[model samples]
Target: MRGLKKEARLPTVYEVIGVLILFIVIMFGFINLLELPIQLALFTSWFMVIGLGLWIGLRYKKLQDGLLQGISNGLEAVLILITVGALIGTWIAGGIVPSIIYYGLSVISPNIFLFATLIICALTSLATGTSFGTAGTAGIAMIGIGQSFGIPLPLVAGAVISGAYVGDKLSPLSDTTVMTASLTKVDIIEHIKSMLYVSGPAFGIASLLFIFVGFFYVGNSVDLTRAEEAMGALQGQFNISWYMLVPPLIVIALLAMKQPSIPTITFGAFLGVIWGFAFQGIPFLDAIQTSYQGYSIDSGIEFMDTLLNSGGMVSMLEVILLILLALGLGGLMEAAGILHVICQTLLKWADNAGKTTLTTLIAAFFGNFFGGAAYVSVITGSKITEENYDRLNIDKRVLSRNTEAGGTITTPMVPWSDGGVFMAVTLGVSTMAYLPFLWFHFLVIIITLLYGFTGKFIWYTKGKEYTENYEDSTVNTTKFEA
Candidate 1:
């Protein structure tokens, strides 16, 4: 397969542009006119786009090998998502989720509303290592509380999304983070450290915004009856105890140890099943069923039931389906050299190192926009940007970091991307509605571009050499430079 890397002729600039326009039209129809489920739309796009990509590949005659390689590359991510679904399902059923709510509600107050939102969403996103999961689960819970308090739903949703992305960007366990580092071949730890330049400032600004927003926002007093009823329902449904906390703690421990995500999530899922039987008095078969089908507890209180009863692999089917379709499309694109053609065309216009960096970043952004998945963005961006990086004498880590900062972090802002779809669905707001409000995502993109142009805080080795033990030795000399 490696031998297939011969210099295949690229499509003309017009052909590349035409393909992009075609992709946009299909996406527009899928989102605006068809109004299909995000996953279904993604799948459909992949089928059509990949077919086109493959047809292009066949002209070069190495398309089959490329498709195989792309699938091979993506296999691990597919497995990881499945495990994540299981882990979350088990964690919820075993009472870890409910336990957090039970304890969290104990300290509930209106004054620190924004701070609380940040903290809760951060913790949940860190635990799940998925901004989407965090938003789907704890975000919903926070929204419920916000509604009860009569806070503006949009503001509450914004806070939840902000905090969730913070964890998604930072968590070593996050798929996008890992995939970013992996595709770029950067040390995961280094990649994270590098991200601080952008993520830290974005987070601080977002936090301050939430704080200021919360200060002027008036919310109703907490309803004691509703809280009490929710608490009672939880107590009756599960043996909600501190012991239920073990599964989440274990997940964190595994992540901190830098264990692979699939195994870590799988372990957590198994532990969840054990907890379900031991504490919740869930029958073994029923527990299995619930774990797969998402258990629903019919506690008398509407909000209480809404909070307590979720855990099931079945719930993630839509996501799985979408991924499969998207992967298929990605496979086809790789086979057809459609992405390569686009990259080569873009590179022709890049005149300087800074311009090259900026171009690569733009390419990544468009990759996410076109591909509709963060993983696709990183993988495609990394493959395409490496030549530009080498030509510019930039560090591979720079390329990798740019891939993430440009592709992964910006995904939620694109309405058709995986993160955007989930955010919109979870928050009950269109991606376009909240796109302007996602200052963090936009900030990361702009900061990445600025840093690329100025070389501010950009570290690298000075020579054009590749080695397994490469490290950044260049210091920031810009402080005194003209």
Candidate 2:
């Protein structure tokens, strides 16, 4: 945004509102009305945003700079996607995926598989402090195991996402958890305590829901033969063993040590390829091809073929394309002054404790909708709301909690966000398809809003009165340069 911010004037209020409305129209309208692909919707929106930038007098060079900055923000996720694609292929070739499927089929009950998926993924993400790593490893394996158990993929994905996000929000090692606290100068412990009030109940309720709903599927029958068939197919193809888990364990160890995500994931991928070639006796050329293009097999059985035939760098092409379009549009809109003006407008509604909290949540969602990254949205949401929380004498942890409500809790449900894209591609479940099952997320929203309106858990400055004199105080909202 360097050159564009210098050359472009702040957009008029009308321009800002128009862009938001137009984006909604295209995002929801085309997707709902015409059943267009999300990629196409993003493409059309990017095109329209470019037109708006030029109309606002932004030069091409400045616009390009803004676009690059936006893409730079999301570059880490795109890189992970590429490496994860390769990781999946290599893991499959290495006998790691097959081992999980083979052993998992022998034990997990179909009736409680989803409940187990929730707990397993939660522990994994909590331990590793990464939703992507959990998803690409355990989450993906759970999906295969769930499919074998005659469970629905969407239901399994819902459980995986619920567990992954729960851990990501709570873990001290998580970027969002750390970032949210740092932004407000609130202690990370205080931040975690604040979130637990709402998240605790949501997690409990979601666990039960998964259990109850999972049992409903067993209404017909639990055919153990289906699982046996899958296990047999896996055993026939690979030298499945308990130690095959070591590769994923290395991934967990590296992430826990806070290594760079791109290289860690890349190392995991290469290790899988080498392990597959060395141990599985897969041909050198075939292993190399699987690492690049993807694993392919003609296992005669349709379901087995679908489950095993996946991965490679090439598979992430569409995900990479969507990331560029969404982030590029976000960058252009911000450089054109649309996002800045939008932030300024939203602050006008934060005149009281309830309104202030509500505004924080809305702003988080707005930032995420336009920013294409949850961590970036955290910056915009918390920065814009920080002053208001101070003015109201509300605890800064309140700001951190509410901001995370949008920034982390509901992010995976927003299809255009990086979090959403990763979940969709990894689990093979669309955001909308898995949304209903993200019971914890929906419950958190309701509870967070009630906390804001009812003044429950809205801790104010301890030695000060809960002041209602916000009117006499002069207020100013600084524009966030996201």
Candidate 3:
């Protein structure tokens, strides 16, 4: 809708495919061969999209409009990212995050350590509705504890990522979950309930795998000396009190009550500042500064310093820029009619519900690969597949779940993708090193695909017809006829 040229010709599916392959090749060359940053690679790819649009005869004005529209769609998400970064900084400075790490370390033993890590990170991410925040906070502590227990960092990173993403997929506060629901016109709660069909089983299996793997490492002699030292450093740095948890609890309570994300997270950050002042004896000026510039702890231990020195609005600028660039590329592709061509070709094969779901899954995966962002995939994939879902009598919740199943889960697997790069950089682990250990990632995809082929857990509508009603120039609504 953003880029419509009445006289412009649409590209053929084959032509679009050619352009896609070329784009992938260029991205690979930049990222793998030249070792460019993912942001730079994406920026370069944006130029490619622009060139293709121009060569295909798309007007510059239309392309510009499309790019602006795409960037505008992500403005809200960008603001949330910045706020989450600030929350992380304030929480760390307030001793909230450290308290979690400190208390979490106390009960976890080598035997059930990996399993406990998965559960703890999962709950934290679910409560916070942020995988990145969970990883940067609780996940960091788990890594330290795992290292102290002689567990491989790669394995720990994998479990942490797996748990973090599980919540990111299911939590109502998650941006991806919200985006999927909004795009598909499903109630957010219903969308979350629908995901439970797939996520519930996947998480159970993943938890069991971690437990089984933990058995082999149980009772292994570990040097608790390093862990004790790290704990001491944490205790000495900030006031270690149970009251530190009040801030995150406030956040969870607000989210459970269905408060909007921006205000909810902002309130949480403010509570962190209050706690920092009241309990941690942090100066008012310092607390305010940390909200913008991030928390800093010079612990002398490089690992502890690395883990503690994070957060603030400034920390998220790179990710924000990456989202904008990726969306800009998506806009150009849409303007040139490349995405329309591809979607139309894919729809040609969707004769039934199962095939349509599978087509959607495939489209979302490729969309993340091409678009370089999960939200971009959701927007494009949902728009392209909505009519198909309607014609097949499938519930929109199914489409929303599949969009997350394919787009959200697949983003962190693609090495050059925004999610992947952010995870790798944040966790201090290579993407390749942690890839094999992400059981939830692999399981979610496999289970979703299995459900698609078997028609298991696919919801269907009964005796209801969907009708679009346009009441005025500014008001359009969908009506359900029973």
**lDDT values, one for every candidate:** 0.67, 0.82, 0.78
Q: For residues 369-443, could you state the per-residue lDDT of candidate 3 as single tens digits?
A: 666677777866687777788777888889998888888888888765567756776676888899999999888
Off by over 4 Å in 1: 1-9, 37-72, 120-161, 164-168, 171-190, 218-229, 395-397, 414-437, 459-482
Scored against the true structure, residue 281 in model 2 reaches a CA lDDT of 95
Model 1 — which ten-residue stretch has the worst lDDT? 473-482
- Residue lDDT tens for model 1, 218-256: 434445566566667767877778877777767766765
RMSD of 3: 5.5
Model 2 lDDT per residue over 1-482, tens place: 66545334566788777877898999888889999878898878876777777776667776778888888888887888888899999999998888887877788878888888899999888877778878988998999988877777888899999999887898888888898999889999989999999999888999999888878865256677888888888888888888898888898888888787789888998888887898899988788778788888776667788877888999889888887778887787766767656666767777787888778887788667887788777877788767788777889989999988977886788888888888998888898899888888888888888999999999988776544343342222222222
Query: Least accurate stretch of 10 residues (summed lDDT) in model 2?
Result: 473-482
lDDT value, residue 411 of candidate 3: 81
Off by over 4 Å in 3: 1-6, 125-137, 140-144, 147-150, 172-175, 185-190, 218-222, 394-397, 415-418, 430-432, 459-482
Clashing pairs in 1: 57-336
Candidate number with the higher TM-score (1 or 2): 2
lDDT of 1: 0.67
The collision pairs in model 3 are none
